[model samples]
Target: SDQISKDESMVGFVDDLQFFIDNRDGETVVGLKQKLEICGRGAAFNDAKKKKELFAKLLMRFERFSSAQQLFAYIMAAIHETFDTKIIPSTSSLSTQEIDAMIEAEIVDKIMAEIGEGSDHMTLNRTHIKGMIYWLADKCYVRWHCD
Candidate 1:
């Protein structure tokens, strides 16, 4: 059974490659590798919907074919954003604005701490930070458009 499952997975991977080659113009072997890397990281997400959404975005971005390292960075960022928001209180005594700020700070600090171990790119803009927060909220990690 395990051998059969492995064979099935291999067949599925081959089918994915065929689909990519047929549809994505200008995609190269390197692009496929990047896609695989992105897909592998995205598969770690526990939520299927979020995983699909994330892979869609990653695939769109993969056309440009940046390093797999960058894709990994985004994956880590998403994981951190989702995990952090999931732990935040859904209903807080603080004002919505205050809670939003706190969430942002917590995310930034966590991302920084994780990345600080090696990477130099520690800065996240307000818009990007807000986008992560909104993404988490949309995933039901917190109240949407509330704190």
Candidate 2:
């Protein structure tokens, strides 16, 4: 199917992101390398299936909403800036989860400030923000650590 049709079938349920996980089939764009990067805790990250579903749903949102597409780009830029300037230069070894948490926190802070300044970015809760980060990982747009 084309992108539009796929998005039509799997629109992002922003109000209830879990709907995607509950309704997802086996379909996913997450390749082997992306999976390896995303599943940082090996078997302990047992929610890979749910994460994949959310990633797919995020793709749908990007396709369906211009605001979402803009947000995606903003998130990618933020992650690159933070990871390159801060995380990479640090001598300490941060676990993937910790790195993700730090990135998410920084992104949220930036976004909140933007919203306060009357930026056009859509407002989303923490769950939606985290979902976007995971989706970025699945799409190879960001990594929790350097390869």
Candidate 3:
């Protein structure tokens, strides 16, 4: 059995955002390894059921987290789920407002401020968020795995 919790496993799937044990799964959540290989990315859904299901479940699961690592996992998962190139939803629940808010609440605004005003070509975007989440997840996952 893996010593790492499910949430830790989620890190590989998602990042450094904080997470903790939750009653929902009756144990620590799992982590991810390199971002979830979401199929179809964001697209259009065949029915409303799937749309509502993912939206509610995913968001609820995220609400259970207490730290950044956990939140990062959700963000990364969102990115993977919404990539739209490799694997996109037939109909995605994600919206610009929702995405922006999530990014702002969990990462974007913080990262932007932390980067400072030195000026550079790179700016906030899916790619930037992707890298940050991966790097952070990798670090936290390693720690949990090693311990």
Candidate 4:
């Protein structure tokens, strides 16, 4: 059952990636590329070889599109999976940094809510919550703030 669930998730991810690749514009692709590069650099000291492999796969997949659409899709999917939010705010009104921060906050809020719900009287420590937020942020390539 777990394997089946994992397979289904992979299929969904691929479908989302294809949709993004087909629909994304140059600006979105550039932004995703920048984020992916940042993620790659951040991982170098901890797991250089794995990070290199992952980045190589990402770059190769990115080459299939005009730009980094796959990476964008992956990041968006990660955010949605973490926060249960599918809305990516339009860049027309908000700057990229603002949008990123908004998404990060939403993710953190969702995580905190889940942790609270799963605990007795929300007894989980601040450090644990912060750790989970940071882990999710790293996985999604988002900038997280405890504030």
TM-score of every candidate relative to the true structure: 0.35, 0.52, 0.24, 0.28
- Worst lDDT run of 10 residues, candidate 1, spans 8-17
> What are the per-residue Cα lDDT tens digits for candidate 1 across 25-126?
333323222332342423423443444455445434433333322533463345444545643444244554665466555665655555544323223333
lDDT of 4 by residue, 10-112 (tens): 2224465555334333333233334435434333334433443454454344343422334335444555454433323243455647655665566545554
Candidate 3: minimum summed lDDT over ten consecutive residues — where? 138-147
Clashes of each: 0, 0, 38, 0
What's the true lDDT of residue 20 in model 3? 18
Task: Arrange candidates, best lDDT first.
Answer: 2, 4, 1, 3
lDDT (Cα, tens digit) per residue for candidate 3, span 17-78: 33312211322323332222221212322232243344334434544333433444555444
Residue pairs with colliding backbones in model 1 are none
Q: Cα deviation in Å at residue 63, candidate 2?
A: 2.6
* Model 1 TM-score (2 dp): 0.35
RMSD of 1: 15.5
* TM-score: the better of candidates 1 and 2: 2
Give Cα distance to truth, residue 146, candidate 3, Å: 22
Best by lDDT: 2
Query: Each candidate's lDDT (Cα)?
Result: 0.39, 0.51, 0.35, 0.39
- Residue 96 error for model 4, in Å? 2.7
